[model samples]
Target: MTTISCTYTGDLHCEATHTGSGATLSTDAPLDNEGKGEAFSPTDLLATSLATCMLTIMGITARSRDWSIEGASASVDKLMSSDGPRRIETLRVTLQLPEALDDDQRALLQRVAEQCPVKRSIVPLINAEIHWA
Candidate 1:
């Protein structure tokens, strides 16, 4: 298992470090949430995690199968709830492939992406739409 440590840096900001890699990232409350939106907010990070996780999983599968996905890119749009509680409503993702993939390969990659840990961990209420580009 991996451990992540975080510290509240005040002013609705926080710094987090990944224990395994010593990698670090910062989070700031969005302007709509009462602080300056100078960086990715916590919810933003959550949305990012989903997309990144998908890509990472797909990459792993591609490598294992001797397929190439170099230069692939993705975009994620995080939509927030309009009523009830403040929360993510949807995570719309668009993935741009570096090269055309065969039907079987595309199907496998799509399955891998949707089965990513982060994607499965999220609430079902948070709708996810994966688009190809």
Candidate 2:
């Protein structure tokens, strides 16, 4: 299992370290949430995680099949709920894949992306709408 250690650095800011790779990232609360909004907030990271996870999984599948997804990219838009408790309402994802892939390859990669662990985990909880381009 992977482990990530996070430390709250005061003033609605935090620093997280990836134990495996020594990679580090900082997080700050959004402006609307009474923070400086200088960095990615927790909810932003959640949205980012979904997009990255899908791309990574799709890349793995493509590599196993001797296909290249060299320029594949994804973008996610996070929308928060305005009523009741604070929570993410929707995560709109746009997958931009290379044009070198055929119809069948594209279809397979789309399926792989949809089944990504992050997507599977957050589906019904958060409305994740994925658009392919």
Candidate 3:
């Protein structure tokens, strides 16, 4: 299992380090949460994770099938609840795939994207609307 460590850097910001790779990232509270929105907020990371995970898995699947999925891109819009615990309400994802793929390949990649680990891990209450093109 991979391990990541994080340290609070004060002012609603934090620094996280990927233990194995020594790569680091910083996060800050969003402007709506009473802090400077200079970096990715915690919730932003969650949505980012979903998009990245889907693309990575789809790429792996395509490689295994001897297909090219180069230039595939995805965008995610994270929506937060207006009331209560201030949690994510929806993650709308739009994926634009290269035109080189056929219908069967598209279907296969779609299935792979849905089965991505982050997609499965997200709470059911959070609506993940996936649009592909």
- Which of the numbered candidates is closest to the native, going by highest TM-score? 2
Name the regions of candidate 1 deviating beyond 4 angstroms: none
TM-score of candidate 1 to 2 decimals: 0.94
lDDT of each model, Cα atoms only? Answer: 0.90, 0.96, 0.94
Clashing pairs in 3: none
On the 0 to 100 scale, the lDDT of residue 39 in model 2 is 96
Q: What is the TM-score of each candidate against the true structure?
A: 0.94, 0.98, 0.96
RMSD of each: 1.1, 0.7, 0.9
After superposition of all CA atoms, the RMSD between model 1 and the true structure is: 1.1
Compared with the true structure, what per-residue lDDT tens digits does model 3 show for residues 45-108? 9999999999999999999999999999999999999989989999999998899899999999
lDDT of 1 at 128: 85
Top-lDDT candidate index: 2
Off by over 4 Å in 2: none
> In model 3, where is the ten-residue run with the lowest total lDDT?
118-127
Between candidates 1 and 2, the TM-score winner? 2
* Global fold similarity of model 2 (TM-score): 0.98
Better of 2 and 3 by TM-score: 2
